[model samples]
Target chain A: MSNPVSERGFEPARHAELALLLEVAGTPKPGNVDRRRDLSGLCFEHFLTGAVGSAAGLRLAEDGAPVGEAFETAVAGMSKQGGGNTQFGCLLLLVPLVKAAVAGDLSPEGATRAAEATTVDDAVSFYRAFEHVDVAVGDPPGDASDLDVRRGSEAESALRAEGLTLSDIMELSAERDANAREWTGGFARTFRAAESILNDEGPVTDRVARAFIDLLTEEPDTLVVTNHGEDVARDVMDRAASVSDLDEAETLAEEFVAEGINPGTTADIVCAATFVALERGVPL
Target chain B: MSNPVSERGFEPARHAELALLLEVAGTPKPGNVDRRRDLSGLCFEHFLTGAVGSAAGLRLAEDGAPVGEAFETAVAGMSKQGGGNTQFGCLLLLVPLVKAAVAGDLSPEGATRAAEATTVDDAVSFYRAFEHVDVAVGDPPGDASDLDVRRGSEAESALRAEGLTLSDIMELSAERDANAREWTGGFARTFRAAESILNDEGPVTDRVARAFIDLLTEEPDTLVVTNHGEDVARDVMDRAASVSDLDEAETLAEEFVAEGINPGTTADIVCAATFVALERGVPL
Candidate 1:
């Protein structure tokens, strides 16, 4: 695999940022904040600020800082620049992926190793990160106790009592959270998307759009499910699957914006996929 | 003025990169390669790569390194990511601007102080930077000898014999090169553009687009003149002056792109203006 840092002349943070940028800039990303649409009071510029501001923390992860802490720091910095929840899910996905790339491997195994290395401090930091921004997520399961994100430091204490690692917590939430699913499963779908994106031809944006649509079709977006409901998420997945052309995708995007459906989690996954491909020197 | 580094959470390099981004992303930058057009075998992606890759060197300039070496280093890194001269002019303007911003004033006077503080080695470094990219420029005047950029090191030697600083060389070329004019005259027009951009209320990209058109209309683009002819450059200026809105600007952009008439120098100025606005926390 090509070393994006030395060969491509961009640091891991820059790679993360470029990935975020390309992901958001990919037009006609149906039901997502893209070039043609802004939803949830978030525009393209907020994402731009978030991505660039987050790069510093992502770089720190290479020095063996807790990835979750780095993710929290990145989110905090992003909010300080533009106080919004834009790219929060993308930031969650990218931090670990960047650490994995900086760990000197671009494979799923490498990503898993990076995720596995997270400690209790990372879990604490992960809980603390919630204090910085209002990231949209589904309610904790009815059966679960002491896992509420809104509990903040209290959740951290409970997580400590249970002695569960950040990765363990992610495993518990994987059923409902696409972002958590990637974390617990070592980003299997992200790696697959990277492969598809790398092998596909045409502009980088087009390839990312294709990968995004494919990812959306493969799974109903968790963000849509969280914000709206499972039915809406399922309907969105079907609509994404129906996008056979750019024109149709744009039409779908308009409809998604009109209906207030944002497939933010899938967009987050696509950002991770983009990071993987870029670390391997995907042509933009 | 807002502190971009502290308050905005973006480093000087990121600010430089953002300036390059907003400048290039500004749509309907008539006769220049904006988001909607490509020119001279260069596309928007190449510019994106260059801007991000160039960030490190821009950061170096903030650390009191010679501005010329920073420019060369930035261009060299840019070529590694995307082999082209997509934003050479913008990079030239940004390096000094970044250094000035890092000097703690973030104003035109501060910019001038940084430029004036440059050394003879900086002049040599500036000459060396030209070897990395094929930047569009007019030939030296009839009286100048051994000053041709194609001479590379020989030009540096001649510059040394004359005991001329980088600013001195810029002063000599200021008449024909808009980028040199910024270097020689403390970026007067750029500061003015920044004032206008600051007072204007809209998206940063839109403000940049309007600034670009205004700048192009106010001065005959040196790149257009160098690539085409004075008559053609004048005609382009006339057409740019006729743009009353973004829609009209978009139409003119298409016509200019089709004619291969690029107002690259004006775009470079817009990048400087963007730097000034962003360093002051212009909402984009």
Candidate 2:
């Protein structure tokens, strides 16, 4: 297939993949995997493998593959490495961004438009992706238990019967899932964090770390809320807000890692923001 | 352009780029950048940037762009990051291997055939790449002073007059440059190291570290020979040979970093070997 994206000499898929790498490599990410640390079940190498493995799927998106097929392909490839859900939310954010980029724009509006255009097949594929890895998600609302992501492919019938587009499904979860919020809310937090990253000084990794901390401070991470309670998630954000510098952030990183307090949703936002910053020509 | 390599469901370019990332991420590589340490002038993030930056050029090679053009383009793109020559020699080896992989065969013979098929124009582009970064090299032999790489594009006319292909230029420096030796010797060391990496147990990063130590022990690094003397290179090999485990390797890593004794040529070979290993299905 002729790739308009490639023809324009812009590699959105590569930029998205690099964003995943840079986000993971950014140190002192406060309980997230980085160059210097790994969680109990995940290592730094797993992130590397996930970033690399996701390339084929990302390229498929760049080549104008259907959003659902591209996302499912990417999730499958990403899960090939043993790091169960290394970049699921990150890819959730990136796949649509890539599709938007392929369509000749990568703005927040462009991404939202792309997300809005996703078909019921896209919803099916997104659900199928959950089968590849164990993603920590809150309980589906009372009215949508049949559409629980944990049901994976089993939710396809319900999704198709209701004629719910991928964006529609995301809207259903927008009240709780930070990643789904980006789909429904035009990626406001992601784009804001991208600006923060572009404006920061020093190395790109440091910039990402700073952005991650800022993001965590600004919002209670949904993943943390699901794993812990709202009170604990609020406490986590309060602690993040107090991190004044990288040294302080490093200390908090140790504490959070020890406590198993991974702000994974915020980290996913950082990954998406990183892609935006890179696409905007933030120097490597 | 239609990419036959991508059409075949293979992504040699991404594999090569990941090889660069994995090589740099492998811990305690004695004298090279890794997850645990960085050289004074080059940080870990710089390698990450270099790996990401080289993607476009790698894609060019995968799309069947001329070997020389692709190599030069990759070098240029890799140099976009501030780390200066982070993966120059690695790219030299990778460009042809990627080309070979794109052609449906990634064997040593295929790589050699790709290398040997280069024309005088390829030689010009290869020298042009030297202009983009400060690669360490010994003095050219007396007979080929006019074609010295340091002369960069200035030696284009001389290369053309002498009818020297990129492989022919490599043959001249093969005795002094371990990377060039791979080009002349059909990547024997690279393939052998790939075997070692694949056969070794534990994480892929650990396997890479093991292969790196083994390679450093087996041969005096050519970059060390250029920066230090042949005697110092031999001493480095001896020191590497004495490293019985990762702990000892870590100790040596501190010493090498402190003393500015980077065995870069060996690291380049390790990167190339990593690509081969990944291609051969060494699980991430």
The lDDT, on a scale of 0 to 1, for candidate 1 is 0.80
User: Which segments of candidate 1 are over 4 A away from where they belong?
Assistant: A1-9, A143-145, B1-9, B143-145
Weakest 10 consecutive residues, lDDT, candidate 2 chain A? A1-10
Q: lDDT of model 2 at residue A241?
A: 91
Give the per-residue lDDT digits (tens) of candidate 2, residues B164-252: 99999999998999999999999999999999999998888889998999999988899999999999999999999999988889999
Q: Note the B-chain TM-score for every model.
A: 0.94, 0.95
Backbone clashes for every candidate come to 0, 0
Worst lDDT run of 10 residues, candidate 1 chain A, spans A1-10
What lDDT does candidate 2 reach at residue A45? Answer: 82
Best-fitting candidate, scored by TM-score: 1
lDDT of 1 by residue, A1-284 (tens): 12123245477788887887788777778877765566765766666667667767777776667888888888777775443777778888888887877778867888888888888778888887777777787789887657887766678778888887888878888999999999888799999999999999877877888899999999989989999999988998888888897788888888888898888898899989988888887875
Candidate 2: tens digits of C-alpha lDDT, residues A1-284: 11111111237998888899999999889989999998886988888878877888899999988888999888888877766779999999999999888888888889988999999999999998888788888899888899998999999999989999999999999989999999999999999999999998877898999999999988889999999989999999999999999999999999999999999999999999999998888866
Q: Write the per-residue lDDT of candidate 1 for residues B2-60, one digit (tens) a residue.
A: 21232454778888877887787778788777666667657766776777778778878
